[model samples]
Target chain A: MSKRKLTIAVTGLNNTDNPGPGIPVIRGLRDSEEFEVRIIGLAYENLEPGIYMHDIVDKTYQIPYPSAGTEVLLARLEYINSIEKIDVLIPNFDAELNTFMRSADKLKKMGIRTFLPTLEQYEERHKSVLPEYGEKYDVRVPKSKAIFNASDIYSLNDDFTYPVMVKGKFYDAFIAYNTEQVKMHFNKISSKWGLPVIIQEFVKGVEVNVVALGDGKGNVVGAVPMRKQFITDKGKAWAGITLKDDKMLEQTQKIFSATKWRGGMELELIKTNDGKYYLIEINPRLPAWVYLAVGAGQNLPEALVKLALGEDVKPYENYQVGKLFIRYSYDLICDIAEFEQLSTFGEL
Target chain B: MNINRNIAISDTGFVFDPSSGDSYSLNPVGTEIIQLLKKQKTIEEIQVEIVSKYEVDDVQLEKDIIDFILTLEQYNLIENNE
Candidate 1:
């Protein structure tokens, strides 16, 4: 008997210096022996390298940016569906996931499936509300506060000290050594991403991350912990190696159980000198380094696709530890005509 | 304005600066402007050529070209003699 071929559409195709997880997720799907995949690459920019990587993307279409609202996005998806008929959609950007989550039911009615966390689950784990989340879940989180204006930085002396982490609501974070730097980052981030900027106590420790999938029923389908070996100036993991830490695995399971979280999530943790794990941020979607999880034996993206398709997927019990992933930039030669076509026609 | 001689730029807009070990990806318009800079074209000449080829007007092209050049200068991909 032959396995079925699936048409999966994925977003966040900007595989640049600061990459998205789409290419890595597609790689996981391509590596699956149980399913053959035809990938539809959804991109926001013409130069998203995945759009030109024909080996990975069967077709590429430019969608409206998330700021365009859900109506425009759904209309674009409808047109794409009329032509390609995508079976599943995996939106990989944090900025876009809210629109997807809100439109998930409409997408299902249009025959497009997605396995994503509920709106409540997504909201509760947001960076702004993470302090309360930690309290509710009994997790150790750094003291943090969300401020709407730069003037609030002056008042942070009560709960925070100098060298606190200044974070935007949606993206960007900087370690500020003084109030001036805090104001600078606050204005910079607020102007771009809008605020309530987050001020957090800087936890001195090694940074670690966990990529895990939940069954939405208090079960962790798969989990892998990795310590970043090399970090880029932008603070992305340039290289990472898996770790065999039972405590990390236990924490992942506990978070899943506590939140009943559905779909893929990345938990960023700071392990202090005293060996305590401090939850830093929770990304509702897979991280850019998810390919490392696939290499380590848990093909999470494949299992996620199956779960979205209403298939019963057994929870992965074990993965090979000590697998290393070193990310390198490759120059993909492409023609200007291809770029012109996609930029003009919004499809290639 | 002169492009850094050590910078290697592919047609696909992948830029590698050997001196800094930093790589960058650019859009088509950005790549075209960099190619023009590499050919030692004056800013006015580059703007005229781009405006004639692309769907942009001279005014918009002028502004865009200046912004692009400033970005290149910030990234240390170009040498500003001025």
Candidate 2:
């Protein structure tokens, strides 16, 4: 008897200077020995390098951007599903997750499965709500406020001080040393990513991240903590090493149990010089550095697929500590004709 | 106005500058304009070619070309020797 081959569609395939988690997630899926997989790359733009990585992605389809609304996205997915019969979809982008989560029921009706956090779980973990989330979860989070207007920067003195962090709702963050910088970043980020720019107290510490998976039943299936060894100018981890930290592991479990979170999550925490971990952000999806967890010993993407398939998976007890992941860039040689084909046909 | 000779502009709109090790992506129209620029085509000639092929007017095309050129210059892909 042979195992059934699963066709898994994945998004966020933009592997560039700022990479996405799709390629690494696909790598994890392909590395799974328990099941075979056929990968369908769901991309937003025709030029996303992962679309050209034929060795990893079986087929690539350019879907409409999330700004096109869920109906457009669902229509595109329906057409794609009619051809590929995608059994599971792993959406890795923060912006696209909302559309997918909202359409999860409809997608499930079409026989496509996705393991993701509930809308409530997703909303409560947003950067602007981190303070309340920390209070509710008994976690230590830096004081933060969401400001809709740049004028609100003048009033931040009530709760915030100089050199605070100004963050966009969806992306981008800057350390604002004064009210002018705060107003500048607020306008810049809000114009690009929309209103409700977040202002947070700057925690002076080293940043550590934990990638964990929960079963939606208070059980953390897998967790891996890593300290960023080298950070890029864009604040991305250029190199990271897995750590043997019980405190971080406990924090991950606490969040999972409290939220009964489903699917993959990356908890960004700042460890203060006083040896206390302050929660920074909770990315509702897997981090770009997820391959580090797969390398360290836990194949989380594979486990997530199994969980999505309704299989009972046991919790992973341990991972190899001190495992290092050094990120590198490779220029894939591809012809112009391929890009032209995808650009014209919207599929490759 | 000139494009940096070291800048490689592929048909796919992928741009790479060897000196800076910076890579960029462009839309199809942007790629076509860069290719024309590489051939030393004047802005007027490029505009005429684009307006003929694209469903755009001269005024809009001229405005877009200027904006695109400004973007290219911002990325250090263009050099103004004059």
Candidate 3:
């Protein structure tokens, strides 16, 4: 039987200490039995490691940053698509999702398909608006408020106790024990990720996560829950195990049903001592540990590509429980010629 | 009085619960108690075995055994208290 050949372009290829989902997403696609894939890595920087991984990424093209705006990004994609004829595009970064989503139709016209959340679905689930999202979706969430100014930190004690969480809009979070610490975190987060930093009441518990895919019409294609066995100082899961957690799966389904969410999502949840789950945040894309879902039998990234191509996908009923995924770092030795090629010519 | 049937306990005191994928290490006493429980030994039989092997008083051994059982229960290694 001949497998369908696909040209899939993926972004967020910075597989560093703070890894991106691109490499893992590419791994899932490469593992697909139904598809023979030609992976085109869309990288924003010359140093993205995925560009150097020749065996994994057939070709790598340096694209403009999201800071350059959607027009510049769409123009770049048009140029890349003219050559590769990309069948499906997967954007794996939180910071760049907006640009790709905004240009989804333009990419479609250019013959590139993308499976992504709608702008409304994207905005409401932002960390700043998560409180209302939890309420609207009927999910339990920690008490939180988005504050725009440093003075707001002084009055936070009236609503929240000390040892609260100070979070940025896009990334970065710090546990602040006092007003001074909150102000410091606020300045640091604001300078990097911009304003409306969120202050959340810290919930003490074990952190468990669910990676799930939703087919725009409220059907969940796959879901896998995992608990971190080891954590890095950056709070990324170093090692994790797939869990037999029905509640987490149910919550993920409920969120999909309520929102009619499209594309891939990761739910960051806290399970308390009393066994209640709190929805901490919703990442609008596949996580770096998403390959664990593939190892556990869901193959969400493959399902996502199939869904993008308008294929009828049967919802995955079950995944292998107790599957473990441990992440490791390895250095890839390459000559400076490869680096020079990517830097000078933009495509390698 | 019952350990989860799916649990794999080693002679060297390593306990692996297949259902939850949680692994635990046990001391010699915990290992002995868990092994006896896996064999469907009654609480009274376990108490007798511990008292005969260790130089501990009956009342103290009973208290210690109950505490040990509760700890196992907390870890969800035990099936049902009944």
Candidate 4:
């Protein structure tokens, strides 16, 4: 039987050691039995590996960075959509999601559907405001504070003990053992991801994760909990296994029901020795290891696209408990002309 | 005692739990106990077998076996049928 064809424009194509979710998301879409996808690789840089992955990405286009603002991004998308006639656009970067979320309506008017969290939903789950989100939603979150300056770092001692996690607004996290280390991390993080660095209490436990999708109607489309079997130094999962964790699944359903979250979300959680789960961070999109969920029986990206198209999707009841996904690096040999094409023409 | 039926013990003492996808490496004695448990050997039977083969006394070995069983239970290698 012939499947429905979808042209999905996806960003975050840099499939490096510190990988992005684009390649994985694309992989999930390609694996869709229901939809035959013509993947439009939306890249910010010329050298994003997914652009060169010919078998994966049908075509690649350069888009303006999110820092260029929503108008500029929408204009670039307008041009891309004119040619490709993209059905759905999935922005996979945390930094770029705000721009996409803001322009979601404009893109819809331009006939580009996107399933993304609302701006309010996005801001409420930000690292700085996680404590409040946890409190409002009845989730167990680590004690944390958002500090703007170095003076605030000194005062953190009054509220927090040593060995707190100093984190950037968007990325980069370090364990600071002293006030001096906190100040150093504060400067480092602020310099990179801007001000209002977050300092969270260090929760000692094994890191587990869940990739889930919500239909924007307080319904869980799918949820797959996983435990990392191997981790990279950059803290990305090299290999992970799907778990039969009912508690984690219940927590994910609770959060989705509470927030009525739209699109995909990854819950970073810490499972303590006493079996209590602590919500560490919530990535407002599907994670790099999302393909594991696909392997486990829940095709979240497929469900997300269905939701974006306003289709009623049945919630997945179960996934293969012990399905494992091990990611490996492959060296793709591409000619320099392909690089020159993307660099000079901004499309390939 | 109900050991997880999905647990697979390799000769090299590597234990893999299919249910949880958790793996553990056991020492020789630990491997022996797991192998014995897989056969539905009771704790007293395991204690008697280990005491006869090894130099350790029955009383001390019994205590050690119980401690090891507790650790196995903690790791979810065995079901809490108690």
Error of 2 at B28 (Å): 60
Q: List the residue pairs that clash in candidate 4.
A: none
Measured against the true structure, the TM-scores of the candidates, in listed sequence, are 0.81, 0.80, 0.94, 0.92
What TM-score should be assigned to candidate 3? 0.94
Q: In candidate 3, which residue pairs get closer than 3 Å at backbone N, Cα or C atoms, i.e. clash?
A: none
Per-residue lDDT tens digits of candidate 4, residues A198-291? 9999999888999999999899999999998898887889999888787898999999999999989999999988889999899999988899
lDDT, model 1, position A161: 80
lDDT of 1 by residue, A151-202 (tens): 7888888888888999887788899998899999999989988878999899
RMSD for all candidates, in order, please.
Answer: 18.1, 19.1, 2.2, 2.6
Q: How many backbone clashes does candidate 1 have?
A: 0
Ranking by TM-score: 3, 4, 1, 2
Best by lDDT: 3
Candidate chain B TM-scores, in order: 0.93, 0.92, 0.91, 0.90
**lDDT tens per residue, model 2, A206-310:** 789999999999999999998888888778888887876778999999889999999999999998766699999999998889999999899999999999888
Q: Each candidate: what lDDT? A: 0.91, 0.90, 0.91, 0.91
Off by over 4 Å in 2: A1-3, B1-82
Clashes of each: 0, 0, 0, 0
lDDT for B78 in candidate 4 is 92
Candidate 3 share of real interface contacts: 0.35
The better-scoring model by TM-score among 1 and 3 is 3
Instruction: Report the C-alpha lDDT of model 3 over A245-275, residue by residue, as the tens digit.
Output: 7788889989999899999999999988778
Q: In model 1, what is the error at residue B69, expressed in angstroms?
A: 57
Docking class of 1: incorrect
TM for candidate 1 is 0.81
